[model samples]
Target: MVQDSPATRARILAAAVEEFSAHGLAGARIDRIAEAAVANKSSIYVYFGNKEKLFAAAMDRVIGDLSDAVPLTEHDLPNYAGRMFDYVVDHPEALRMSMWRHLERPSAGPVVTELYERKLEAMASEAHPSGLPPMDLLVLVVGLSGAWLTSSRDLLAAEGGDPYSAERLATHRAAMVEAARRVVDGV
Candidate 1:
């Protein structure tokens, strides 16, 4: 329970995020994090215990930042999806960090579970009343966004494909809205 100054703590956390996101727990280096934070290694260890804990904390902060960027709301589904896609594109680092975590089985920790549960609650509140369960709605939301974020590169490389191109994104946005409508309408 060391009460570090906010500025120092924020810098360490930011640096840790970049390090852990770029290199998983096994590959991440405390020296690099310290350098990036402009703080000594001792401070990082004192604040976060160890590299594993720091990685988890960094991930948690990323999740918090994302929640702030896209506060959950009872909005239309397609609009929500569009916002999610836009956020991921804008914050590519966060997306990459998350993907790295998924790749590295850090732990089945409560922080991740709670983050997901919050997402589920928001999705359930916004889901179309097609009798779809909360989990299903959650899956749909995550699945669509995950597909877009993870596959955007490959999708773009496809012939005549350009996922980030204005026209393609717009079309995808429209299709997502229509899909939501159909799901909700039970069509």
Candidate 2:
């Protein structure tokens, strides 16, 4: 049987997130995850299936944390983007995981789809006044908040500035909020 302990599962998930974030699904090794988690490889397979499933579980856990920590509303799109921005900044690997999933997985799993459904429904209810479809607005909010975290280095290089400067981060964050506001206003 699997280790079947919450401690072991949590450890594996933590290790898996780090591994998958650093190397992605194909490059991540089950042996490395097991070593990092202080569990055996067999235990990981039993608890989390193959490497793909482990990656999915890790993504799901973090996404759930974000959903709980940053619920969205179309009326408060800017603040919603700000919260998402903060969360993505604190956990940049989550964005990396998302990008890797899009590249590596053919389609999202049912659980991930369900999470989107709930958020879309909530946004749709409030988005009628904004005149933009909920999906479009949702994409804008997440993309605006996360775009900097994912591409700041290249952007900074083009601007001839430090990518990790506090000033840069602050300016980008404020811009994200303004962009979100404009997206709503434009609609």
Could you say which candidate leads in lDDT? Answer: 2
What is candidate 2's CA lDDT for residue 141?
A: 76
* Residue pairs in candidate 1 whose N, alpha carbon or C atoms collide under 3 angstroms: none
What tens-digit string does per-residue lDDT give for candidate 2 at 1-187? Answer: 4545888988999999899888988899899999999998988888888887888888787667767777766468789899888887788776777788789874543256676788778766663555878888778777888888777566659988686587888898998899888887774
List TM-scores for all candidates, in order. 0.75, 0.83
What ranges in model 1 sit over 4 Å off?
1-5, 106-129, 160-162, 165-168
What does candidate 1's lDDT look like per residue over 69-98, in tens digits? 875543455566667777877787678777
Best of the candidates, TM-score: 2
Worst 10 residues of 2 by lDDT: 106-115
